[model samples]
Each structure stands twice: as structure tokens, then as C-alpha cells.
Target: MKAGLSLVACVLVAGGLGAAQDYSVVLPTVDVEGISEQDFTKGYVAPSNVEVNKNGLSIKETPQSIEAVDVQKNRNYGTNDLSSILEGNSGVDASYDTRGDGIKIRGFSVDGGDIYRDGVRDSGQIRRSTANIERVEILKGPASILYGRSQGGGVINLVSKKANFSPLYKLSARAGSWDRYGGMVDVNHVISDTFAVRLTGDYEQGKSWRDGVKYRNKMISPSFVVTNQDGTVSFEAQYTYDDAWRVPDRNPEKSVYDAMGISYNKGFAHNGDFVKDTLHFLRTELNAELVHDINLKWIAGYRKASQDFDNFFAGTYDVNTRMLTQNYAAQQTDNTTLSSTVLLNREFEGERVGHKVSFGYDYSIEKREPRLKYQRGFTASIDPFASSSSWNSARYDRVSTHNKHKAITHGVFIDDLITFDERYHLLIGGRYDWYEFKSTDINQNSRSYKDGAFSPRIGVLYDITPEHTLYASYSKSFAPYGGNGWVGVSTTTNDIQNLAKKQTNEQYEVGLKSEWANKRFMSTVAVYEIRHKNNRYNPDSNDPYLWAQRDEKSRGIELNLLGELAKGVYMRSSVGYMSAKTSGDEVYGYRNGLELENTTHWQGNVFLRYAYNDLWYLEGGVTAYSKRYHYVYNDAAKSAKGAHLPGFVRVDMSAGYKFSKHASMTLAVNNLFDKEYWRSSSRPGDRRSFMSTFVYEF
Candidate 1:
């Protein structure tokens, strides 16, 4: 693949070099803050400038559906973690399962392996701390060209806080219902004109609505930077360590309404719950201006993490006896990840055209070891209303080594954006990746497999005006099979045999982006169709082993509106509708066009904030979703029709007051109406939790 790319590069460069060089202009860059602070972040909207794309084209010139949010601003609007941050964006639904954070984009669930930090892939089940985050970007549609081997749903890019050459200090404390309490410290010091350092830390402890569920967590991040006065060269190092002990939340159960025609034990806690996790990561980077029109940058990162869990909320239910039978399970993991990347960016000018070119290579190595154990007799059964729901792990003698695996991936990608007189933009990019996986079973024997893919993307953007643009794009994406689906880890042969090929998907999208009132308002609407292959499922073949199939499809429309709505008023809202279904051959006698499980056909949200005075403000939001199916339909078998989750609407409200120039207080109420809504099949959302925060900055 490397040799083939080199040949292709030679031809592209040779062909373009023949053109006469007769112009000079400033180089385009991917600096999210380059556009003036007010334009980049004001009101409730963030800038169109993004660093996720290799080319620094604004969102209007990217020819794709995209969303971004300013963490600080969203914090006032009840945003937390990647999922909540995306609530104001179209076609995104965030949820939490026994795992950690999960998200659905355009009818596709993005696996943990597809999440990214900065420009590198992450291999840990992260809960996502906001202490070190500045902003996040959701790059919609096919993004493999920039992200390497990944799902077709797109990638979530987090931009961490950077050290600034100035003095900054902030302190904040928060307390809320369910005994929630936390505090944060953020400090930045300019030791010298050429060197600066920043440290951010947070600590929290809380009890949940569920009985016996409690959590304690702490995180500390320190970043340092060194640069010459000329700003032509710089070096940075960032480090973080997080520790947490949490009582796992109870899982959702079959609502009594389904069986007894009434809600019973609907929000009951059903777990012996415990989970402990720790993570450490270090990232180093270097940036240099190599020539008058060329630059270089590189990043090296390492991460180590572990999780220990015992007693979760998984059990079997006996409807007739109105009883629950339970089991005690314990699990743990030890993992290490190493990655590095080097990128070169250059700019050239022609009489009426220009180019922004980028080339990069990245490699990653990951290793994991896991242990599992179970005690079947610990908690044999619990009466539906039993008061004693305890399990005894001391009775279990031996822990088993279930599985351990490692993976290595190498990728090389190149991107180029050709600007024609600054009106029409043509972008092209592609990447080649080679991935290998090896896993070991309890018997100490291991198996290995290898696969690769070539992802390509191209788009065109036309500017009707500086604030209005129209564009279209088509991209290719693929994900290697045998991925554990948890942090891009390795999968064992017992889980997926052969694993010879990868699932592939292609996307075609067209959209319009517009802005008004000097960047104070922005709106975007996009229509897209995605055709996916290798979405395997056995067609109810009663055989001991079944082969995978490859046909699934989805189409959708997304709309996002943000920025100022009226005088001293700001609003952010989004809506999405999609039809995702199985195609071609029937599965388990289901119709070829049955809707996929857990996918909603309609989802939308709106949040608005109004500034009453320099010292007072108010914000409120509403989130809604249409019915979602929980199972696949047996279309040919009328007796096995699928069931759907009823649609729901939720509301939240907040108010704030600035008592002084350096101090402010805010109060927020979630589930303002105390609506009893389920986030998934069995997990009900928190009901009317109140939070109060006080912040001081200098």
C-alpha cells in the first residue's frame, strides 16, 4: 500500500507541477480560533472553524453535515459528556448502557473504537471528563479518509485545553440532588515569555436515585508548552490521570405495563452494583515551520487503563412467578495503548487557483488482558418485592482468565483542497490502513488475523455569498471485523470466525449552510443516503454456525439552527428523521425492509436562553423522540411482531445570576416536569434532579 501511494503521489505532483505558478496568498489552516474570538464563539453557537478536517475550510465550505459546540457555553444549558453536547445537533441520540457512553448518529451506532481524541484514536472506555475539554466536533457522514479504519457513521473529535501564555485562575463548586457534590480547579501560569503551564483538576462524589448506587471520582490534567517568540516552532506535553469508584446503575426491566397493564417496580434498583476504573494518558507534540510555504507537526501518545467490576444488574425474570433469578459476575481488564503520527502541510499558488495539501502517517499498538469470574449460587433468586438483594462473592473460589487480545494498525493518508478564485472549493482525500489482531483463550493458545482497506473521499463547495454556501460530497468508510466494539480492542476467533473481511459503507450528502447578522446566526440542512454492506446476520439457519450477510441501508434528513433569535436572546435547536432497515434477504423470516432495532425514526431538540440583564439570565430546553423498536420483526410470522417503545418528551430549565465581576451562581433542574421517561428499554432517566453551581474566575 505504501508503494502504491508513493506512485500515485508522484503522478499527482508531476501533473500539477506543470501548471504555471503566478500567485501568492496566505495559507489556510485548521485553527478553530483563527477567526476572531467573537465570531468563533458567541451566544450559544460556536464557530464554523474546526480542526478535525485537515484543510481549515469553514463549515460552510466543507460540503458535509457537521456540528460543533462550545463546552463552556453548553455547560450553562445542561450539557455534559459527548452525548449531551450533541443534543443540540441533528441526527444524534446519546445513551448509556452497562458499558459507558454510547451514541447513535444518522441511524448508526458509533462504536467506542471510532471515537477520537485530538487527531488520534482512543482505545479506552472513557466517561469523558470536561475539565480538559475546550470543544468537540461531530464530523458527520463517511470520515475514514481522515480517521483511518472506522464506522461509516462518522467520528467525534475532542479538542483538549491548551496552555496559553497568560495568567488564569478559576475555582468552581457544585452540589445537587441525590447527594451530588463536586469541585474543580483550573490554573494557568506564564513562567516566562517562552514557556507556559496549565493545570486543571476536578473531584466529585455522588449518590444516585437508585438505592445503594454511589460514586466517587477525581481527575487531574497538566499541560505545558514551550515556544519561540517568532511562533515558528513549538513543543507541548500533556498528561492526565483519573480514578473512580462507582456503583453501577440498575438495568431496565420489562415494564409491568407490558404484562399487568400497569406500571410496577418500574424504577426499582436491581443490582449489587460496583465498578472501579483508573486511567492515565500522556501526549507530546511538536510543530515547526520547515520552509516559507510548508510546515510539519507530529503527535505521540500513550495510555494505560483498567476496570474492575463486580455484581451488575443482569438477571432472568419469571413472569408467571413474579420472581427474579440473579447471578453474580466479576470482571476486570488491564490495557495499554501506544500511538504516533507525523503530518506535513503545504500551500502553493497559481494564477487563479490555489492548493492546501496535507500528508500524514500514523501507527497504533494496543494490548489488553481481562479476567472474568461468576458465582451462580451467590444470589439464586429474589422475590419481586424482596428487601434483601445481596450477593456473596466470598463463596466463589477461582477467577478465570476469559480472554486477552492485542491489535496494531498502521495508516497513511493524504488530503488536498483546491481553491478556484476563492469561490469554488474542491477537496479530495484518501487513506490506506493495515490492521492485525491477535487474541488468546483460557488455554493459553492464541490466534491471529489481518485485513486492510482503502477509504477515499471527495467533495465540492460553491459559495453563493460569504455567508451562504451549497455543497455535496461522497465518501467511503469501512470497519474491520473482529473488533471487540469496546475501545477498538481485539476479538477472539470464538466470537467471530473467519473475520476475513470488513464491513463497508458509502455515503452521499448534499447540504446548504447559511449565516446572518455578522455570524450571530447560523443554520444548516442536509439530506443524505447511506448504503452499507456486510451487515451480517444469520437468516434463522438453525445450523450450529451461520454465515454473515451483507445488506443494510439508511437515508435521512438533518437540520440545525443556532445563534441569536432576538434581542439578547440565543437559541440552539436541531431535528433529524431517518429510515434505517434491513435489505435483500430475509432474516429469521423478517421482512427485507424491517426497521433496525433501537433506531428511532424521529428525534429533535430545542434550547433557548435569554439574557434579562448583565447580571441575570434564563435558559430552557425540550427534547423529544419518536417511537423506537426494541427487536427485529418476523414479518412472515404474524405471531412474532416487534414491539416499539412509546415516544416521549422531556424538559429542562436553568437560571443564573452574576453577583460580582469574578463570581456567579447557577441553578438547573433536569426533568423539570418530573416525567417518567425511559432512556432505553428498562433504564428510566433521573426525575427532577436539582443542581447548583458557584464559579469564581480571575
Candidate 2:
């Protein structure tokens, strides 16, 4: 790790301009002070404001429900990336994808949401690394009006760390439970007053212990930055690569069905004699900005990302009389995306009001190839004990399915923040988007449509006093749909799926932002009502094998508090209450009527931190989840009415000691009570774990 840091520093310095330029450059910066106190107790700081838009706006000033997790707090809580960090927030949840490549947020049908790096869509995919991240921002409520298309719930922004510019070097390493181990290195150099460079990397592996969870990961990134002072024009470029190996589900299909109380016959297969997953991803981005002496400025950026995944699941199920041999199985997907955006900003109304206009386009191409082979149940003497059992009738190999599709999105937007006086301000924004989708598998169903939508945002900031501000906002969101699959007999038809199920969301919010006691403490109290409409779901489809559709609604309220106490102690906490239900009257596929399944009522977290002198610090926190229900098998059966995963509470703690300004050691423990609780209503929870680390920075 030390060698790597040294190498990066040498290279960056070597690239420095021979002589200092009259102008300075614009690059990334970290604001370590704005992070939560609990994080400060963990021996790390983000080193920048870490706010939305990367404009250094304060959380209290941003007209949205925004929260940032500092690098320090991340270490204290044992977080790896967006998923782990968000688990502590009140209104967030995580789920695994079928391919086990990334995590899904909330109860949204998808695995990931729009991602931002320095306020730009860094990458749209959910799979990402935490090493390059300096801090994370969670924006609650409908954001599609501000960003492009997005869910009604919220968005997570990953603030990437920029060049130190101040000349610094750091290295770290660690080995822990499950044979997990890895190292990281970071360095920056100010080639001249105008040029700088930075580099970071990570390598980790572990023999996971979960029944079917074992894997390893490798990630590397290198970046460069050049800027001209007057803070005008700047350029940044980065390349990243990541790879991982995963093993999924070792148990047979029946066990899963039994656990979830889902019906399964002998004809359907769900187990894999052996499963392995390999993934490769490459991403590149370029960003530039031009700021003129006038209040006018221009910002533009472009990004490209590509990934491939391979999966194989094979097993047999027990059918009726004849011992049947059923084979269920194979999938592969290749995804690629390219996007570009440009925006103009300027001040008006004698600098009392301002406006920013942005326009961009995105194109994505996806391919899915699936093949399934099945046969009647069978009982053969052909050694079922073999790793590759005999019942495995790999008949699907002969039939191949090829599917390719492309999606295009174009959008234009303008925002205005108007101030009536130094004490009052108002903000409004509108956006228009057009979408097109085409697929090779769709016959007449495959169609193209154009729709224009204007979502408005209204906000007000009232300065009650120098130390207090009252704010309120209303926002809306609409998300388009992609093509769905269907079963065709002889030839495929272009029955392009209709846009009947477009997702809609809106939020009404009010909050008080305050700084008190000589600015030593800060706090915020916010209340919100969020609603979703035109939701699509498979209703009454209890037959585990059936796919259907229905509509549901989720609404909730949330509260949060953060800041420092006396004597270097800091505290942060939040709580949420939500109720979600399907409308009683709805019709889609099979069943009808309304029920409760996609709603959670309560969630919250409390984090605290304290520093006892320069060498030592202490941190602790707890995240709580409320009870959730799942449809049970045999609703008439005495013990099979409704499956309930009782609410659970987990605690985490960390302690760190600094040897000097440049070195530190820390230890952290998660699930401290060893309480066994389910992380998902459908899966068992993991056991308690521990992690420790040491680092040196120059």
C-alpha cells in the first residue's frame, strides 16, 4: 500500500508544470468538517462540503430532503458503498438482484436508481465501489423534476474525492473474518498552481460463509485533472475496472419454496448443482466547465459504461406419479450506455435571481439471451450423487433465444431561484422529456411513442432570524417503462408493450433549519407526505410460478436531527412512519382485490460520536426496522396465515486512536448483540461481524 501511494505521488508530481501559471484550476475538493459528528469520532473526514450539485451548498440551504454521510461515519459504521451506508437511513431498503451483481433500493421493482458523481450521472448502474467515494448524499422525495427520470422516493449521490491539490499521500491495509483482506492507496500533487493529479485503487477477496455466498472482487481506478484559475475552465478524466466471482444458492429448490411458503410442483426446477458468476465492467467520463467574468457559465459532460454477466442454474423438481426429471434454466445479459449533457447558468434580477438551463440525451442498448430445457420427472440409477446429477436433463442447450433492444431519452430543463429580498427566496423548475424504445423480439407490439411532461417544483426559504430558516417545497416525478417479455407461439410479434403503467409520484414537505449557540450546534426538523400512483404489480399471483400485475400506494412521514454537543460529542438521528396498501379495486392479470405487502410502517436510526483528546475517539449507533408482512401459503392453515418478519434492531460501535497527524488505528463491530434477525422477509439474516484497520497519511 505504501509503495502504491508513493508511486502515485511520484507520477503526479512528475506531471506538474515546470513553472507556476498565473491562473489556478478547478478540481475536486473534500469538506471534512460538514460530515456528521459520529463520523468525526471515527478518524476520517470527507474534506469538502459534500453537498448536492457540487456547488458547496449547505444542507440547510438545499430545498430538498438531503443528508450526507461523511467518510468518517462510513468507517465507523462498517459501510462499503451506497447500499451499506443507506441501510442506516430511515426510508431505505436493499435487496439482491437475480444475478447477484448489485443491490436494489426501496421496494422499487428495479435494483438501482440514478447515480451521481459530483452532481452528474456518473454511472446509471447500481453496482459500484466505495473507495472513490468521499461522501454520500440522500435526497428524499420526488427528484425526477431536478434530475432526469427517477423514482418518487429519492436519489443517492456519491461525491467522488478530488485531487488533494495540497500534496498528500496515504496507504492502508486490512485482513479480517471470512478470509477477507485488501488494501487501498491515495495520493495527490499540485504540479503547479494550475495542475494536479490523483489516483486510488482496491483489491479484496473472501471465502464467504453464507450457505451459497462466497466471492472475491478486484477494482482499480486512475484519474487526471487540469484547471485554470479564475475558477473558469477545467477538465477531468477517469477510467475504472472491476471484476468479481460469486456462488449462488446451494440448497435445492423445494427448500426455498418451503421457506417462503410458495407452491411448487415437481415439474419446475430451482437448484443449481453448481453456480458461478463472472462480471466485467469498464467506465469512462469526461467533464468540463467554462465560467465567464459575467454571471454566465457553461458546464458539459459525457460518460460511457458497459458490463456483461453470465449465469447458469440447473436442477430438477418432483412432479406427479412418474418420477419426473425437470430442468429449469440459463440467462445472459450484455448492457451498454452512452450519455452527454450540457447546461448554462447565469444570474439575473441584479444578482437577486438566477437561472440555469440544461439539456441532455441518453442512449442504452441491452441484450438478453435465455434458454430453458425441461423434461418429465425421472428416477434413474445414474448416480444422483454426482456433482452433475443425472436428473439434469440439459435439453434447453439445443434451443437458443436472442433478444436485443435500445432505449433513448432526451430532456431539457430550466430552474430559477428568485429572491424577493435578502431574507426570502423562491425556486421553480420544469423539464420536458421524450422517450423511444425498440426491440428485435417485439412484433407489432414493438412501438414508439412521444410524450411531453412538465413537472414543476416550488420552494421558499424564509429567514426567520440570522440563526434560523423555514423552508417548504413540493415536487413531482414520472418514470417511463421498458419493454416486457411475452410468450409467442410460432413467430415473435411486435406487440410493443403499452405505456399503461407509467409510474407517478409527488411529495409535499416543510422543514426548519437552524444553527444555534454560536454555531456550535446545528439541527433540522422536516415533515413530508409522499405518494405514488399508476403503480404496477402482479396481484393475487400466489402460485409462485405466476406473473401478474396490480397497483399500490405508499405514503409516509419522516424526521431527522444532526449536529454537535459540548466537549466534542456529536449526534445524528432520524425516524420514519409509512403506510402502503394496494387499492381495493384494480384489475390486471389473474387475481383481484387489495391487500398489504409492499408497505413498511416504521424505520429509524441514531448515531453518536465523541472525541477524548487528539489520540482517541468513540462512536456508536443503532438502526431499527419495523415489522413487514408476506402472503403465506394455505391462508386457511392455522399456522400459515400471514408470514411476519418481526421488526429488528442492530447496533454498531467503533473506536479509533490517532498516533499522530499522519497515522491512525481503528476497530469496529457490527450486530454487536449477535441477535439473529432476517435482513429480508424471504431470507435469513447474517451473523455478527468485526473489522479493524490502520492507516498513515502524509
Candidate 3:
């Protein structure tokens, strides 16, 4: 089947190259801050302007490292999810598992409390879909001045597709390996001279190469916009549902398995071991602009989400008996969030100095209810080399517990961009936040805490010429204990600790931004060091569940380039190097100078797209990563020899042909060489795969 598909793709590409013609493709206008309408079909270069900072600054003027991924163009490369798109970026490590999507920026984890949609905080417990996403913007370094109580690593903001004045209709179908199939629809209509409505939706269902793994995802979003002389008002609502069932696959130690005369690909997971997860999400947003001169803006958003997962995973392998134990756990959580922001912007003109000032007040309240159930020995032991028919034969011993948590946050921030002599610029910003957290356990034990923090940022930039700029910046951020959904605070239990203090992060950075080929291309190089304090970690290896406070530090350098390399040829590439290690006194089991787990020392990605005429195009890319330790405490004596996952490089290629003015098709081959690598210490990465997609516009 794979050979047949490859042949078909090659034939299509060969035929398309000879019959290709000059075709100018235009897409629907995207309604986003700092981005203007343009022909995206020509190149993958994204706009320089970004709204991630909330202060309205271009990439070169922000004195920070920033990157944007154009999801529309990435679709042709078989990039369908947030993790897949982020994995190819500089200084970002992203992966997806049964727990949902996880990301680390600059060697720091940003899995929760640092993700947003349209500038509003969104839930990070579930896998995010790209069906309704227009583009993803990443801001590197501390961002607490504009966003309160977030990870110091950085922020990921998803720009949602919104209703616009232009009329558009599109339909698409896709099929890939492992019986994967899906469809999508996008429609926009003008209801009146000043009103427009848009709807977009997609449905996907597929099985995985792994045994007994299946998933289904569906989403629908409807939006309406009203335009007038004074300003524009818009409303948007979205609904998303996801369901999945899969058997956990944990790769065993090759040395031990091979020594036992067992096959490397032998499966240890029983049929009963499974993961079942479901999520339901609903969101509504209202944005209005009152005055055009000062650019007064108001945004109100509401989100309600519920997620449930039930799973049993294989644990501890008894080397003597070659038997694997099963662990069962289940959780159900519901979340509700209400957020609002009001901002005012104005510019003061002066002969020698000019100032652009922006100030905003934002408030948010979130309530979460989570219930959990678990059992240590849920089922009987299973043989590593034999299949088992026992499934759910045992019941959970621990009863479910209902817990409630609520958080209320209010922040006020102001930023001023001062331009001096039309060549030098200075940026100053500060934010103050008041946070309150309340929690109630199943036994009616209640606790409340209040905290306040002040975060500040400063930067300076000097334009050397029309195409080059140099900048330096310093920033700080903070996050309260148990702020994100993953952690919980309890007054009656001894498990919760360090309730009086908050985690803090500080960073120092310097960078240069340059434009080439008459502003058709851009490159940025940045070097930064970040210090994190009050980090939670397990101090005792014997009791791995115990949590204690520690400190960590990371220093990294990154280089990123994007835009057209030549006429009809475009390229995007990046490389990053980081040294992440623990700091301060050595704890009981952890030693100072130990590298952080799951962080690689070197990573890089390079992609190039060549337009073989206007109607046909070909793209190829490579992503590589260095070896990473799976355990935080990498004691050579305790760890298995050659236990660390080795470095790997994967290559991918895609070809697209415009068959007609209204139709097109794309074929993508991932892992072209069928490389065998481990995604994590226990999980194997996907083998070579192929996907084909067809789209029509009306």
C-alpha cells in the first residue's frame, strides 16, 4: 500500500510540473491584530506585527525573540496539530501523548497556564485542534507584565479565524495512513452592508499504527461581525469535541530485553490496558472598538470545558519474572472561565521625541471541579511475550473524590514606546496583579489564599540602518502555587507544601534583527539566560511523589530565518542550543549541575519550498535533536547502560498541484527514510507515513 501511494504521488507531481501555469491564488482575509490581508498563497512568510504582547508592537520593535507559524500553509505539510507545528520551531520542544500536548520553551516547561486563544487564556489539559486556528504566535521569555501568573518560559497565543467582509466558501477532504480520513468546510456570507457571518467546521477520525488506537475529533465555530465608521464589533462562538481510545505502548530496555532473548518489538501491554478520553469545549467572545482615534478596545470572553479520562497503563517490569504490572487511574474535570479586558492606546507626536503609550486593565475568574479515582494493582500481571484476554477484570479500589478550586485575578499594566531622534527606541512596561485562590476538598475542608505581585519589563533598541537593529531587554514573571489545573492546594492534607511563596522567573537577553532582499526576508539572533526560583521537585528518590522547592537556570542562543530566498523560492530555518541545569545546594537525591530531564542540548529545523511554476510546488524539511535524558537524576550507576534516547534526524517532503482555479491537491510523505526513533524514553515515534488532501474553493 505504501509503495502504491508513493508511486501515485510521484505521477501526480510529474504531470503537474509539465501542465502548470501562472495561477494567482487568493485566500480569505484574516482578522487579526497587526496583520493585514495579503496573498498567502505565494510564500509562507508571516507578518511581522504581532498581538502576543498586548502592547501592539512589531517583531523588530519588541526587543524580543518571536516566531509565527502560518497554519494555512503548513496544512500541506501534514501538520494538523499544535505540537506538530511547534516541533519545527527554534528553542521549542513539543510532544503529544495521552495526557494531551506538552511543550517546553527555552528548556522550561510551558505545558499549562501559558497557552492562549485570541489573547484569552485557554485550557491546556486537552489536545488543541488547529481546525479553527489561523496562526500561532510564540513570544519568548518572561511575559508576566502583560499576562499574569504564567510560566517564565514564554507564551503561545493562537489567533482564531474570525468573520470578515469578504465572501468565501471552501470544502476539503483528507485521507492518510492507518485508515485516517476527515473533511472540513468553511463558509462566509455577507448578511448586510455592515454585517458578515462566517462558519468553519471539521471532522476527523482515524486509527493509529499502534495496536488498538483510535481517535475522533470534531469542531464547529460560527462568528459574526459588524463594521461601521466609529469602530467594529464582533462575536464568535466555538464548540469542540474529542474522543480517543488507545492502548499504551511503553518501549522496554533493549539491553535487558535482548539479554532475555525477547524480540525488540514484543508488546507487553495487555488488551485490557487502555486509555479513554473525552473532552467538550465551548467558548464565546465579544470584542468591540469604541473610538478610532485613541483605539479604545474592549474584549469579553467566556469558556466552559469538561474533560474525562479513564486509563490503565503498564508499569514496573519485573526483570526476573518478565511480568508487567498494571496501574489504573481516572479523572474527570470541568472548568469555567470569565475574562474581560479594556485597553486604550494613543500616540503623542513631537519633533525630537515621540511616544506611543498603551494601558490595559484585565480581570479573570476561573472555577474548576476535578474528581479522581485510582488503584495501584488494578489487574493481574501479564506476560511480556503472550497476549492476554483479561480486560477490566478488576475494579478500582479507591473511591472518587470531588474537589473544587477557584481563582480570581486582576491586573493593570501600562507600556510606553519612546522613539528618540527617529533612530533609537525605548520600551518600559509594568504590571501589578492581585490574585485570590480558594479550594474545597471532598471532606468540606476549605482554604483560601491571597497574593500580590509586581512584574516589570524594560528594553532599548537602536536602528543601525534601514535593515538592521540591535536590542537588549530585561524582564521578570511570577506564578502562584497551584495556579494551573495540574496542581492542587489542600488544607487538610500534608501533601501540599510551599503555600506562602510563589515561583519567580527573571531573564536577561540581547538580540539583533535584520532584514534582507529589500525587506523580503528577515533573520533574528538572540542570546538569553533565565533564572527560575521556587521550582517544585522531588527531593527524595525513594519517595518519588514528595515535592520540595528547588532552583534551575537555563542559558540558550537561537537563530531564526524566514521569507523568500529567491523568486518563487522560500525558506524557513532555525537552530538553537541550550544548557539547562539545576542550581543551589544539592538536595537529598538530586545533585547540582545535573541537566534537566527531557531537554536536549541542540536542536534545529530547516525547510525549503520551491514553486515549480505557479501551479505546482515542492517542499522538503528536516528536524533534528540531540540525545536527552529521560530521568531527572541521571546517576550512571543506577541507570541502564545506553538508556538515554539517542539523537535522531527525520526528513519530510510534500508536493502540491493546483489542478484548476478552484481545486488543488497535496501529497505529503513524513519520515521519508522510515527512521526508527523514540519520542520519549518509553515511546517509539511514528514510522514513515503518507497523507493526501484535496480542497475546492467556490
Best lDDT among the predictions, by candidate number: 3
| CA shift of 421, model 2, Å | 1.7
Give the better candidate number (1 or 2) by lDDT: 1
Q: Model 1: residues >4 Å from true position, as ranges?
A: 1-43, 73-80, 256-272, 374-379, 389-401, 482-499, 536-548, 584-591, 632-641
Best by TM-score: 3
Question: How do the residues 200-301 of candidate 1 rate in per-residue lDDT, one tens digit apiece?
Answer: 998888887766667887889998887655556667788988887777765435554355332432333445457777878888776666555666666788
Q: Output candidate 2 Cα RMSD.
A: 7.8
For candidate 3, the lDDT comes to 0.71
Put the candidates in TM-score order, highest first.
Answer: 3, 1, 2
**How would you encode candidate 3's per-residue C-alpha lDDT over 491-586 as one tens digit per residue?**
554645563468888999999999999987899999999998877654543342355666789999999988888997888888899888877634
Whole-model lDDT, candidate 1?
0.70
Q: Candidate 3 vs. truth: CA RMSD?
A: 10.5
Ranking by lDDT: 3, 1, 2
Candidate number with the higher lDDT (2 or 3): 3
By summed lDDT, which 10 consecutive residues of candidate 2 come out lowest? 482-491
Query: At residue 472, what lDDT does model 1 achieve?
Result: 88
TM-score list, all predictions: 0.87, 0.78, 0.88
Alpha-carbon runs more than 4 Å astray in model 3: 1-43, 229-292, 376-380, 388-393, 482-487, 492-499, 538-545, 632-642
